[model samples]
Target: MNVRHLIPTAAVAGAVVLGLTALSACSTSDAADRRPGDKLNVVASFYPMQFLAEEIGGTHVSVSTLTKPGVEPHDLELSPRQIGGLGDADYILYLKGIQPAVDDAIKLSESTHSVDAAKLTTLEDHGTETGGDEHGHEHEGEGAGADPHIWLDPVKYAEVAKGVGASLEKTDPGHAADYRKNTDALVKKLDTLNTAYKTGLRNTATKTFITTHSAFGYLAERYGLVQEGIAGIDPEAEPSPARIQEIHTIAEKSKATTVFFETLASDKTAKTVATDTGLRTDVLDPLEGITDKSKGDNYFEVMQSNLAALQKALGAK
Candidate 1:
């Protein structure tokens, strides 16, 4: 993807206002890499992007996330302070179309280096429902756009990780070799993860799983399974009566045993499906962010937990 350095009008206005307000906050020693010993200030939009930067930039970069733990990234609205902070980032790492506010902030800020992870690989539409199911509701502004949960597929994530490492190399050329080495290590780990998922989900009795949202399209597709979601791409979108009926029909036909909900999203819809049918309910986290309810601290651990949940729910022998 091309680097975006153009600031929109709104971003320009916000920056001017913030610049005036914070004129006395600190001296001109306000560059992203000001202090000689300071790490590269890498501003990431949310958890996945932050994790990638930390993994590749490891020790060489200081990564900060805009969305705090336990928060939903899609609904994030940046404060003026956060917007100003973007200006101080040596590099901005984000997936375009996942968070609109962050996209606008990147456009508005004059940050020297910015990476859009979405550009690293192809994004499939993976329409919310299939096989004669009714059209489910999507987020208002996100109609029919490509799914943003590419990180769920380890292969795709590894590709994005490589792109991030390349960006870091460009931004910090002195440590280019380190970035490349770290990128290779991260890709190897992701390849191992891909192998685990393939082996674990290969012999499942059924190839279908139900969920509160369509966040697992890439994962399911990668592992030869199908995802039946109550809602469309957006988890916050309420499932209509027709949509619920569709999912019920799918679950019964596929003999799906569980309705999976994610950590950051409410389980009410999944539970409702479980209640209507005789299926159980379980957590199939999307790993949008780290939360108190998350089974592990980082992306890899949570993904492994998710694999275990899928294996049980899919009745793998």
Candidate 2:
């Protein structure tokens, strides 16, 4: 998380270019660009937040994301310009514990309209089983800071959507009606998604699924399935031999058929576990960010693809 110390002094210009490339890569407006508009400048922490802002704020807001597309968000280190650019935002939306740099930068910025999505929805510690690097770990004294991946759960995400809508209404009162309408539409879509997952996964041959990243805890719990993570919370962390053996036992006992991995993270762990267990490997995207490699573009499409993957893995009848 100490990104500043590692910033290379020799590649300042290259880093700037890389940063510019990142800014362009997400295909969102830059918060720092001086624009002649009354549109609210909304800076999002990442795709999940960005999606909500775009869906809810509509034409009233110009949204930008700190974490670029295709990049894993946990290790996201903000450039100095990106950090300073936070002050230019009319409203900022972020989840507190996921990105350390964004959290620190937002706290230091003078943006009063910043909204923490975690505050809008209740967070549950799905524990380390389905946890990943940032969202799934237990904090020392902070009471299991709850999983920051609430956006993965449609119901929970709907809650965050309502909160975001209200916040935007408060920020830009002139567009309150539009924000409310958009929020309702999004929530309705989420409701339909929730129903689909419920019906699709209700009668599965297995209730347990194995995964390399523990990013699907909420989704699993929501659909009455169990998640066995090869690596707890941190995707880069290697599984201990005992843990690997335990997964093998669990996979067999629970009749698990697939070892799932994310689009952004390395699939080696998933493949290794699947190969050893004689189970198939499949993509069960956590829906962190959309990329060319993603099953579908945007949240709803990717989530539908996720539902299909889960149904296939669990052998839904």
Clashing pairs in 1: none
lDDT of 1 by residue, 166-228 (tens): 888888887889999999999999999999999999998888898776678788888888777
Worst 10 residues of 1 by lDDT: 128-137
Write model 2 residue lDDT over 1-317, tens digit each, in one string.
11213333334444444544555434443333435556888889999999999999999888999989988887676775786556656789999877766776666553566899999988876554344222343322122336677888999999999999999898777778999999999999999999999999999999988776667778877887877767666554567667778778877788889988888888888877777778998998887789999988899999999899989989999
RMSD (CA, Å), candidate 2 to true, equals: 6.2
| Most lDDT-accurate candidate | 1
Q: Which ten residues in a row have the lowest lDDT in candidate 2?
A: 1-10
lDDT of 1 at 251: 81
- Give lDDT: candidate 1, residue 148: 77
- Global lDDT scores for all candidate models: 0.78, 0.77
By TM-score, the best candidate is 1
Q: For model 2, which pairs clash?
A: 130-214, 131-233, 132-233, 133-233
